[model samples]
Target: MKDIFAKDSSGEMVSPHEPGYDALIADIFATIKTATEMNTGYRTPEEVHEYMERILGKELDATTTVLPPLYIDYGKPVTIGRGCFIQQCCTFFGRGGITIGNDVFIGPKVNLITINHDPNPENRSATYGRPILIEDKVWIGINSTILPGVRIGYGAIVGAGSVVTKDVPAMTVVAGNPARVVRKITTPGQQ
Candidate 1:
C-alpha cells in the first residue's frame, strides 16, 4: 500500500485508480461512521470525548469541547487546539489537513472542506487536497463554508452563512458568498 501522505507539486493527490486508495477510503468511512454513531449514542461528556479522541487519533485538550454529531472524513488529518469550542453538526473534510488553533469557536453546521476534484471532467475522480489553517482566537459563524486551501488568520470572524473562498486577514469580519471583509474588529482588551 502506498503512503497516503505522499505529496506532489499540487499537494496531496488521491486517485481512485491508485493502489490502496479504495481500502483507505473504506477504512476512513468506517471509522468516521462509528465515531459519529458513538457521538450520538453517548450521553456523558467523557464518553463523547473518548469517541472523539478515537476519531481524531489524538487527545483533545481538557479545555476543548466538541459537541456531538460532528462529521469528519479522514479524522487523522484533523487537529484541534486548546480551549476551542466546536458546535454540533460541523463537518471536516481533512484529506489534506485541518489545523484549528487555541481559543477558537466554530459555530454549528460549519463545513471546512480541504479537498476538491480535478477540473477536467475526464479526471474528475482525481482528488487534490490542501491544508486549512484556522489560527488562534478565530470565530466561525453558523453555516459558513470554508473552502479548500484557505488560511483564516488570528482573531478573524467569519459571519453566518458565508462561503469563504480566500484567505481572511487577522481581526477582520467577513460575510457573504465568496466572502469579503465587511469590517475590521478590535480585539478584546485593546484600546
Candidate 2:
C-alpha cells in the first residue's frame, strides 16, 4: 500500500518503507552526530548564518532568518512552512518527524526534540523516535522544549523555558517545565 505522507518524485503518495529508507536514516544519523558536536565558537551573526547554510545544505529564506549559532539535529524528516522565524541557539532534534506550520515564531534557545532513548543500557544504544507537530500561528518562547509525540495546536503560546511533554490544546497559553495551560487565547489579535 502507498503511504500518504511519503513523497515521490512528483510529490505524490509513495511507500514510506521504500528502498531509500535505510540510506536516509544512515545519512541523518551521521549528520546528527556532526551537528551535536559543532561549536558556534563566538562567531558573528553573519558568519554563523553562512556556516549554517553550508551545514544544512539548503539556502535559508530571506524572511525566515535564523540567528547565529543555531544547532539542529534532524535525524528524520522536518518540514518548516513559509514565513517562519526561528531564533538563535535553537536545537531541533527530529528523530521522529517534525512538522511546523506557517507563520510560526520560535524564540531563541528553543528545542524541538522528537526522540527518546530507552532507559535500559542495552536498548539505550538502539534508536527510537516519535513525531512532533506544531500547527499554524503558534508562538514558542525562548528555551522551550517540545518533546516527543507532542502536538502543539493552532494559535497556542508556549512561555519561555517551558518543557512540553504532552499535547497543547488549540488557542491556549502554556508555561512551566512539563508545560501546563495558563489561559486560553480569546482573540487572534491579542498577544
Candidate 3:
C-alpha cells in the first residue's frame, strides 16, 4: 500500500503508506466524481461538516466548520482559525501551507492552491510552493481561487469566481481573475 502522507523529492508531501491510505484515496476520488455528477442543489452545512470529518483524518476545530464535500489534500499543513466557515466543495491543495484567519467565511467551491509544477516538462518534476494567507474576517465568494503566495488582507471580500493572484489590501472587495479592488469593506456591519 502507498503511504498516504509521503514527502516528495522537493520535501513537499505526496501520498505515503498508511493503513487508511486506500480508503482515503478512494473516498477522495469518489467525492470528486459525485460532485461532478450533482445536478445543482445546495448541501446543508452540517452535512458538509460530517463528510469532512469522515474523509479527513483529523478533527477540525469546533469553531472551524467546513461545508460538505470539501476536497483537501491532507498531506500538508493547513490551519483554520476560530469561527471560520468553509463552504462546500472547496479544494485546499495544501502542499505548502494554507492559513485561514478567524471569522473568515469561504464560499462554496473555492480553491486555494499553494503549489505549482514547472511549465517546462523537463523541470516539471521539481515542485515549488508558496503559502496562502487569508486574514481575519475575510469572506471569499463561491468558486474563487486563491493562488500561491497570496495574502488576502483583513476584512477583505473576494467576489464569486475570482482568481486572486496578488496581495489584497485590507478592507477591500476584489473581483475577477487576478482580482482587482472594486470597493472597500468599511464598517463592521458592511462586512
Candidate 4:
C-alpha cells in the first residue's frame, strides 16, 4: 500500500506520521525553541542575530531586524530579504516555505500559516501545504493572519488585525476578516 500523501519529487506535504516526518519536526522544534528561549535573556540585537543565524543555518542580512520571541516551525524553509523588520512575537509555520521580500515591514504578533490538515475527519492527520510569497515593500500590520498560499503583492498594506485569506494586489489596502480591499495607496507624485 502506497502512501498517497507522500511528497513526490516536487516537494509537497506528506502525512505527519510518515517515516522521518516526526524526526524532522522534532529537530526543528528543539532547535527553534532553544534559540528563542535563549534569546529572551539576551540584551543586545547582535546576540539575537547570531543566535538566529545558528538556528537557521544562514546569516540574516545585516540590515534586517527581527525582535525577540519569534516562533517558527521550521527555519530552513523561511527566507527573509534585506532590510526587513519583523517585530516581536511573530509566528511562522514555514514547513510549506515562506518567502519574504526586501524592505518589508511586519508588525508585532502577526501569524503566517502555511500548512493545513485534510478536511476529511477520517484522514485528518494528512496534511497539505503551500508556499507564501510576500513581495517587496509590503507592510503587514499588527495581529494579522496570512493564510496558506497567499501572495501579498509589492507595496500592499494589510491593515491591523486582518485575516488575509487570499492574494492582495499591489498598492492595495485591505482590512477585516477575509480581508477586502479598502483602497488603493497612491505613491508620491502619482496624481
lDDT of each: 0.87, 0.72, 0.72, 0.84
Q: Candidate 3: give the clashing pairs.
A: 2-16, 2-17, 3-16, 3-17, 4-16, 5-16, 6-16, 48-67, 48-68
Query: Residue 101 lDDT in model 1?
Result: 99
Sorting all predicted structures by TM-score, with the top scorer first, yields: 1, 4, 2, 3
TM-score of each: 0.92, 0.71, 0.70, 0.90
Local lDDT at 90 for model 4: 90
Clashes per model (N, Cα, C within 3 A) = 0, 0, 9, 0
Clash pairs (backbone) in predicted model 4: none
- Candidate 4, overall lDDT? 0.84
* Per-residue alpha-carbon lDDT of candidate 4 for residues 57-114, written as tens digits (9 for 90 to 100): 6878989998978887677667899999999889988767789999999999999998
Per-residue lDDT for 81-173 in model 1, tens only?
999999988988887789999999999999999989989999898888888999999999999999999999999999999999999999999
Q: Give Cα distance to truth, residue 152, candidate 4, Å.
A: 0.5
Q: In terms of lDDT, which candidate is stronger, 1 or 3? A: 1
Candidate 3, 42-95: lDDT as tens digits: 656555444544444345567677655656664225677789987777888765
TM-score of 3: 0.70
lDDT (10s digit) by residue, model 2, range 1-191: 43332432123322324556565456666666555444435665465445555555655454555564556665336666777888877888765678888889999999988767656675463345677899999999999999988999999999999999999999999999889999999976666
